[model samples]
Target: MTIAIRMPPDVQSVQIGEQAVVFIDDFLTEPTEMVEAACQSQFSPCPGYEQGKGYPGLRATAPSEYSLRLVELLEPLIKINFQVPEQLDLNKSACEFSLTTVAPDRLGVMQRTPHFDSSSPYHMAVLLYLCGPEHGGTGFYRHKATGFQRITSENLQTYSDVYSDELHRAPPKPRYFDDSDDHFQFLGMMPARFNRLVVYPGSLLHSACINPGIGVCADPRRGRLTVNTFFDS
Candidate 1:
């Protein structure tokens, strides 16, 4: 099967906290191929996100071609919007289709809070929602203690120190984090829509706002299936 992205992707720009977020609708000419591919692949527990920390879900490999074309098509926009270098190496990127399969009982304390992927300014995250609004959307947050909207190397230590102190005082509950809490404040949520693509900095404090009522469904066609890619230099 052939894959193609929409020409001059219907891009919209927005700010989530201090990060530049790009939302593209009708991103692919054949998005169902991605869903079909996910339906066919075997999924496994989402392993350690950082330093062997458990993530709340299941994940499977995605089509490499999708990753390649996505970056190629968004090159100019990414440079201007994300404020990155002109050269983006797809070889340095990653692609995956993940399903939010964790139940509250199975969630880890760390997985219940918002997280930044890396401290590097160059790192970026691109996600394509393959489900309906009922599945939920992605949210940006602010660390209430540190007032950190986007954690950078200069403030990573400060953020970490404050977060560690809070973690011990009161561990996060075993459930998907929604709006606000004592530690993190939700800035806003980018609603998930079928075939909608969203991108933001990896340093932004963010989390998936998984719907509690839907529980967990492994079926890609029915659950919160998403294409998550880390695009960087």
Candidate 2:
């Protein structure tokens, strides 16, 4: 089957605090059938968190054709929207099909909270929603104490100190970060829409709003299927 890919005339962007989130609707013309087949065909259990907390989900190596096409479509946007150099270095670029697996109760203290994919401002994440709205969306947060939305090298120590202190004072319960917790405030939310893509800095504090009732399917087609990519300039 030939996959249909569509690009909007102009991508929409939203700025929250210091973070700029780019959104593109109807990103894939009609990719559900093809992508779902690919995801269900082969998948491996996602690796444990780097800090050895808990596994978030499962991932499958995406097809090279799809990966190459995605990079081609996103590179120019990244350059223009994020203001990266014209000459892009994609040595660290990766494309994969991801599915959420671990339940909220199983999440570790760290997993229960929002997190940054990386602390480098140069790094960015692109997430394409493959499922419908029943699957939860993504959220951006602000660390209430420091008023910091994106953690960086300069503020990492301060963020860490505050985070540690908060954890000690009142530990997070066994659930995904919802509204304003003691430490983080919900700055904004991006609802999950089929064929929608969201791009934001990797340093931003964000989390996937897992719909406990709907999104926990182990089956990729029925679960919260998202194409997650990371790029470093």
Candidate 3:
């Protein structure tokens, strides 16, 4: 399942609020090799959005060679489609192997909601799904109150104020955020597929659609395994 470099990698775009989310199938020639490599690597708890205890699982930094290769292969398309300038800094970018393990009920309020990687529109996140569909995919969200589908520096304060108020007024259920709720509306999900790669602006509101049926597991082979990478200008 190898999608050739073909300049920018073959892509299918899904427009979400003026943003183009590019998804590609058959992204890796040897995805299993990468999976096995990750399984044998060291992993630790990934810091969360607020309280230093957010992500439900463990993570390990991806090999530098692998990150360099991906940046080399995807930069041209990112520059053109995302309109990033030539001086886009790779220093802000990172690549990591992640696995979701914490149960839905064990999650914090922050983990139960959607999040943006950065406030800058120039920040892009490239996610490679190394597991099967049973593991679930990523879902984009829109704030019901502010009607904000994208979170930027300009709207951050406004969105956060309204969101915080709503949470205090009426708390959300302690469960995974895969569907619509009182605050955020579920727009759609990019279904997970083995060796599938998708890239989108990190500013967009998004959450991992952790399948409650599968629960939590630390094993990379049995759990949800993903290659998370970020780039910003």
TM-scores of the models, in the order given: 0.93, 0.91, 0.91
Q: Worst ten-residue run, lDDT, model 1? A: 47-56
> What's model 2's overall lDDT?
0.79
lDDT of 3 by residue, 74-169 (tens): 787688778888786644466889888777777777777898888987888999998899988999999999999899999999998998898788
Q: Residue 32's C-alpha lDDT in candidate 2?
A: 77
Cα lDDT tens digits, model 1, 67-167, are 77876876666778876766655334667888877677667777889999988887778899999899889989999988998989899999999998888
lDDT of each structure? 0.82, 0.79, 0.81
Clashes (backbone N, CA, C under 3 Å), per candidate, total 0, 0, 0
The candidate maximizing lDDT is 1
**Residue 70 lDDT in model 2?**
75
Query: What TM-score does structure 1 among the candidates reach?
Result: 0.93
Which model scores highest in TM-score? 1
Superposition error at 116 for model 1 (Å)? 0.6
lDDT tens digits by residue: candidate 2, 1-233:
44545855348999876778998888877767656555556766676743436448777766566677677777778888988888767444657788877777777788888888888867889888988888878889999999889889999999999898988888799887757787888988888988888998889999998897778766877888888889886
| Candidate 1 local Cα displacement, residue 32, angstroms | 1.4
Model 2 bad stretches (over 4 Å): 1-4, 8-10, 49-55
User: Candidate 3: lDDT of 58?
Assistant: 84
